[model samples]
Target: MGKYDPLGGYLRRLKTDSVDLGFAEIERILGAMLPKSAQRPQWWANQIDPQGRHVQTRAWREAGYDAFPEAGAERVRFVRRQV
Candidate 1:
């Protein structure tokens, strides 16, 4: 993995109901700026990457969480699942 796979690390460390983080905060965790696509709604869909080698949503799902980006908002929320 990259030096800063925020989703993986964040999901691993989640121990609360949810986490609300702005793009800047996420970027900090990622150690890099997000791509322009990351700002689009489609990018938040739980889909596979073009290469199909991995599921884009696997990390959060495996961590028993779901992620949602609020419409017209500047932050994304990662909510824990009850299981």
Candidate 2:
């Protein structure tokens, strides 16, 4: 399984249009620590690199969600992407 596959699985199970979770909570779901890059907003952007380096993006996007980090907060709000 991919490192972020568990996160994808988690998001796929949610029924809400949006879900908010702390960094710690996400770490728990990931069973791994997020990279320091996670502190930046761009890390949560929906775009991905050509090398597919941003596995986390594949996770949420495939699950039909997008992550929005609350500035100055340790939490992120994942909104279901509009189809």
Candidate 3:
């Protein structure tokens, strides 16, 4: 593994939080959060469900506990679980 891995030590340095935001919104936040010279971050795998929840596969939408759009995106905020 490398320093840039999701579970790597570098990730701990990210300015993350647990807040609600739409997919598009989270995308913008991630763009701002990452270092300009590093590889782009990607959404955690557990949050996505290719054959299950459609919202997880697509953009964010209001749906009960799923109300937290940031939970499904790669952004630091709203991260339910880490790699």
**RMSD after CA superposition, every candidate:** 2.7, 0.9, 11.0
Give the Cα lDDT of each candidate: 0.71, 0.91, 0.33
Off by over 4 Å in 3: 1-17, 31-44, 47-83
Compared with the true structure, the alpha-carbon lDDT of candidate 2 equals 0.91
Residue-by-residue lDDT tens digits, candidate 3, 11-64: 234355334444344435344343332122333223446565333313221111
What TM-score, to 2 decimals, does candidate 1 have? 0.74
Question: Once model 2 is optimally superposed onto the true structure by TM-score, how far is the C-alpha of residue 11 displaced, in angstroms?
Answer: 0.6
Between prediction 2 and prediction 3, which has the larger TM-score? 2
Candidate maximizing lDDT:
2
* TM-score for each model: 0.74, 0.93, 0.23
Give the per-residue lDDT of model 1 (tens digit) for 22-72.
Answer: 978878887878778767777666554677444546666666677788776
Per-structure clash totals for the candidates: 0, 0, 0
| Candidate that would win on TM-score | 2
How many clashing pairs does model 2 include?
Answer: 0
